[model samples]
Target: KSFLSKIESYNITGKQWVGSESWITQAELASDERKNILQGAIGFALPQASIPGLREFLLSLKPSDEPQSDVIKAFWEKFFDCSFSPSNTSTMCNGTEDLRTVSSDYTDVTYFRAENNVYKAVYLVAYALHALLQCRNGSNPITGKSCVTRNEVRPDLVLEYIKYVNFTTQNGAKVFFDENGDSVAQYDLVNWQMKEDGSVEIVNIGQYDTSVPEGEKFKLKENTEIVWGGNSIQVPRSVCREPCPPGSRKAINKRKPVCCFDCFECPEGTISNQTSPECFVCPPEFWPNEKKDQCFPKPTEYLSYKEIMGALLTGFGCVGIFLSLLTSIIFLTHKETPIVKANNSELSFLLLFSLKLCFLCSLTFIGRPSEWSCMLRHTAFGITFVLCISCVLGKTIVVLMAFRATLPGSNVMKWFGPAQQRLSVLTFTLIQVVICIFWLTINPPFPKMNMKYYKEKIILECALGSAVGFWAVLGYIGLLAFLCFILAFLARKLPDSFNEAKLITFSMLIFCAVWITFIPAYVSSPGKFTVAVEIFAILASSFGLLACIFFPKCYIIIFRPEQNSKKHLMGKIPP
Candidate 1:
């Protein structure tokens, strides 16, 4: 106050230089340097010196000091009252537009206050800059240590600027993002430097690029190239993924990863991953689709040629037996080999039975599996097998006995007289019958369709229960007949008239040869040709019977009419 009082001492109409002399003289008179600070502090209370309504606010900071600081008389600017200022419009204070908006009464005074106002206008900015940057504070644009001039603005003012300063990019600048924090596109490196006048200049020497030593375009690393017009990116030279294994499938649109490719597998019943672009399933009738990847059961309709051949061969064997029976009967009737032989005529009966049995084998192919014939077919086949074997056994025993009788000093011939011969035949016949009954009782065959699989319809087949059973019977008969031929060969040494053995011997040989050859031929031939086996065998056996027995008798009866005597015709001899 003393210094301030002295400053007013010399000033009335003229402003004097009271700062140097008065401050010095006054500070010499004072005990502390507090006078200057106290005087300045109190200066905020003066009228016309105070900031608009700011005087009231500063006064409120020291209610008791109002009398000493002379703050009660401080002028209040109505515009600074905020209540009188337009709402939301005081924001224009940063620019000169607010003055233009002022009422006309204030226009005349603008020029008077303009110069001083300008100094005060930039004072806070400079103070903020200087304070923040630790530089000298002033109203000049150059007064601050750089950071683009700092000492010009106080720290508090800098803070205010930070809050209020709006930033916008100049034309040459652009915004970019570098995820790797490496290079900026075509932009030069910049560094801050303080000018002697306290302004900051960012010196741009040259463009920055680690891609080349100097002045070169950047080349990106692989997998680093952007895609889709900068919408995305991709890794280069990735490997593809393989498909799923067998018996599996993939869902639609299930995406594979970058390093993997999509693949699908066929399902359990359905084969997949075929020869084409996608997997395929096997059709119902055809097994193993295009994939050739899996196996499945084909329909019965697709049976192989061999299967069909087996069926036809079976059919032929049946027809042969039928014809054989007819021929045997014809021979018996013409030769007068009476069916009603008083005692056991089992040999005659077995031959007849064998022929009948063979006929029944053909019935197995009557139709597909049907209820009426179901059980009968198996029984018929079994019986047929027994009968054929029985026939061969009977013939064997007949040949053996005949030869024994012809042998010198061998009495087995008389022991097995006519009745004994018949009994021996019956023995084998009954034995075979018993065997068949036993076989059927132990293991019955069924033709019930297995719906799980397709229904198998037999087009051609043996009348036998099964092919194996049929062959088993043939094997037995063959072994027996082979032994019969050996016996007959020895028996042929006897007188031709007494033995008459060549007929049976040759017939048996022919029969054996036919069946044996038929088996192989049937196996090799297609099913369509299997019928030949039956027809040919029938014709051979029939002709053999006609030649062996009937033809000889017919020759005698026709050529030697007298030879058809009472004994030859009716009583005894084979005419």
Candidate 2:
């Protein structure tokens, strides 16, 4: 009562109270003022079984009856505040109560005069003595005598018999002690439920018996409702921290219990759906969302025509095509002029056509790479460049042959006429065509999702299936360009009237310089920039060839008509 009064003074509420049998029994037996403080508390109690005739014996007590001993007389006088009398007319003490019936205050008691554990102990000792004195065939197996004398009995001997004693009590409950000399553990789960009258009731809500099977030892009444602390229906939590939520992990506090922890969100590119020690990394082609709870497929990236860079490159390619066609128109209109005729008009027109194809091929590299575009981009670039170089090579040879024809009895014109020039261009271009066909048939380029180039996105670019084949095409174009550059260099010093070789030499120099830098830039560039570098190389080289080779002739035919005359070609009218 004093301990419960201390708890009541603290005014602690909403906290579950649990205790052993003695602690709970004290709460149950406390005065109403003290017991009210423990309302809704839960605790364990030793399981009780009703004792036969014990309630009847307690109710049958009367003050008129003689006390059995001095202690009994004194207890009866003190409890009832009256002495025992044989001839009392009233059966109650002080004429206010009947001794034969129990008081209303003690009605909650289940048994009288004996505790459940005390009853079990009495039975345990009786069984041990019974087994100790038992004789078989006139011989006591324990002591090797008909009956063991009381003087021969010892506390250790009696205890040895008590260790193996097994019996059932009057309530049909099996009683036995374990090797540790302890009886089977049995407890009743009790809850202190408050009543409307401000009194508390100790209700048996569950049971726990060690004699039952392992998992079946503890059980609760399914229909029984538990009354939590502070008369609340919800069970109070005693944990130090709440659980970590999804998309997060538990970070344990140092020198604290495992229940006490902090939650940390998953890092970028990793995902988790529960309280885990670590997050899982997303796959190569996947990325984690903002919440880091789910993985999504990475966005595909390519040099699309819609983006600013691709649009700019496409615009440049279109300009190149338009300029090439416009140059062809100018050459056709001035075909009769000395400048156009002097520069070999047939090869000049063919070179413009091939330059237009080169510009158009760069457009193929601008869009999303597919199977057809992948194959066409590289093959078309190789073939068109070879054809363009072939035209230049033929023109360079013609300049040398024409200069030779001016000498006496040279006869070089018959060996290298217009038909031979066309055949030479055709033969050189046909070789590149065959090489492109074999490259496409053996190991062609194809579109691929490049994952290693970036962490958060997929690069949709053309993958060259055979590096050797790709490099071989570039090598073959380089071989033709080098040959053309050397031939043009040899003929550069010829007379200015018939010599277009100097312009060809300058065009080949720009072409070779652009491509020589292109190899290193293409190799070092990353993601979509690699394709941009290649397209820039193609556009720069094509523009160099167009400006260097034809711009001078168009100026002569359109702006300098006097210089386009036969006297200018024969060097007869020098300014």
- Using all chains and alpha carbons, the TM-scores for the candidates as numbered come to 0.38, 0.68
lDDT of 1 by residue, 1-575 (tens): 66445544653221111122112222233222222222211000000112243333433442233434433222222333332224564332211123334354333332212233343435535534543554334333343434434334445555543333222222222222244433233323222222344333332322434334554643233332222111122322323544555545544454655446455555434665434444566654445544446656653321122465545654555665655565555545545432223112455555566555555554443344444354455455445544554454555556566556657887785676667756755665565556556545555344442323332222232223445644554565566567666766666665433234565677667767776787878666543244345445544553453355334544554466455454443336653
What CA RMSD would you report for each candidate? 27.0, 7.5
Q: Per-residue lDDT of 1-575 in model 2, one digit per residue for the tens?
A: 56667777886555677866667755344454544456678888887677666666655654345435666455555556665565364233342345444354333446422376687788888877877778787776755756655677777767878877878778756788887888788888988887765566678899998777899999997899898876778888888987766677778889899889998898777888754556889898899888777789999988989999999999999999999999999999888877888878999999999999999999989888899999999999999999999999999999999999999978989999999999999998898888888888999999999988788899999999889889988999999999999999998998866468999999999999999999999999999999999999999999999999988888877788888888878888883
Off by over 4 Å in 1: 1-270, 273-297, 301-322, 325-329, 332-346, 365-414, 441-476, 497-499, 511-575
- For residue 374, model 1's alpha carbon misses the true position, in angstroms, by 8.8
What TM-score does candidate 2 reach?
Answer: 0.68
Lowest summed lDDT window (length 10), candidate 1 = 40-49
Residue 436, candidate 1: alpha-carbon lDDT = 51
